[model samples]
Target: MIDGAAKDVAQILGHIPALRRYARLLAGDAAAADDLVQDTLERACAKWSMWRPGTDLRAWLMTLMHNIFLNRVRDWRHDDGHAALEDAPEPAHEPMAHAPEMLDLHRALDRLTPALRSALLLVTVEEYTYAEAAEILQVPIGTIMSRLHRARETVRVLMEGPTDAQRTHPLHLVKR
Candidate 1:
């Protein structure tokens, strides 16, 4: 039993980096992301027995993190004294080593709705399959596809300006 528990701890520890990455992208604030990861680890440790031995632990952990994040968002909405999560200023940090385009992509990601951003990050950044991402997000596969589509399009527009079709389309133009 001790050996089994030790193995479980090791496995859970192995997934922490992935959790931190996902949390950072999802929260868009390093401090908030670290808090989210810590919360997730605490919950996982408390519920370790409930996890099946052969299951995909990373997906399970991500599901817990996602649920926790959603709950926080819901709570934040009800709390009148707190500033909006999105309105919180970006945390100070060293500049990223990536190019200007990567910075733009990050900014575009920050602008996405939480649901859309979650879907995009799970699929693109974390490299989860559509089915896996759907399971993690507790949504249907079709819903994941739709969210990914919208998220990608929004990011593209934000990064590259509108496409030619968008520029030429009467419906996309401002009416004076």
Candidate 2:
């Protein structure tokens, strides 16, 4: 039993970097991402005994982290003004010029509904399989596909600078 537990701990430690990257994508604030990962580790440690053997540890940890983030969002829902009004320290000394393409992508992402954004982050950024992402997001597989469809369309139109209405229709998707 001790050997099993030790192995599990090692497995969880290995997933930390991937978890941090996903949290950063979700929150867009490095400090907030670290906080979320810290909370996730604390939860994992406390609940380690509850984890069964022979299951996917990475997926389990990700699901826990996702729930933590959702709770934070729920708590912030009632707040009115933009919270956390501090400047992110610029990339030391020399920051890359703000590329127009990058700016538009960020703006388009900002417009996504939270559900769609989470799905895209999991699938595109984290490179999770559809099944794993659905499990983490706690959504049906079809829902993941549909959200990705809609989010992509919205981003495409926004990036291309407002194409014809026909192109904007979600049903008429032109997959990239």
Candidate 3:
């Protein structure tokens, strides 16, 4: 049998394509995706010895990649003097097939607190369970549920802004 280190290396190799696929989806830029994948690999290799065998390696690697991205963003913000975000030309906006509600939904998501947005995306977009998102975000399950509820409410309010204000008469709150 190969040594444990060798086995770990093989496992990482097997996971590279999946990692790249996920990174690509996350970054939306090919070069940035590759960088994210590389960052994840470097961190994973460094921590290989500590990784317990037969556990969920993919989730661990994904968590590591997420941290790598968050750290890079934190560093960029911290170094505003020399590493400011450049004024790149915006990509031309093409018409999407989304409904009016979708536009409001996207805007509301962008406007959400990062904690709430992240929780919502992890659970809804990425299809992670509330428990899995909680584990990944290092928050309690209750926090995930609260964030999900808040995110949905925010989106609904945004989508209904005009309609809500245009009502001719207010509905009674009484149960009669």
Q: Which model scores highest in TM-score?
A: 1
TM-score of each: 0.88, 0.79, 0.66
Candidate 3, after superposition: displacement of residue 92 in Å? 8.4
lDDT per residue (tens digit) for residues 14-80 in model 3: 8787778666545544688799999899999888777777877876786787778678757766885
Candidate 1 local Cα displacement, residue 148, angstroms: 0.6
Candidate 2 matches the true fold with a TM-score of 0.79
TM-score for model 3?
A: 0.66
Give the per-residue lDDT digits (tens) of candidate 2, residues 90-143: 433323236778767766887887788888888898888888889988989999
Looking at model 2, report the run of 10 residues with the lowest lDDT sum.
Answer: 88-97
Answer with 2 or 3, whichever has the higher lDDT.
2
Candidate with the larger lDDT of 1 and 2:
1
RMSD of each: 3.8, 4.9, 5.5
Report the number of the highest-lDDT candidate: 1
lDDT of 2: 0.82
Better of 1 and 3 by TM-score: 1
Q: What is the lDDT of residue 19 in candidate 3?
A: 75
How many clashes in candidate 2? Answer: 0
Candidates, ranked, TM-score = 1, 2, 3
lDDT of 1 by residue, 76-166 (tens): 8898999776997766764773578878888899899889999999999999999999999999999999999999999989999997888
- Kindly give the stretch of ten consecutive residues in candidate 3 with the minimal lDDT sum: 83-92
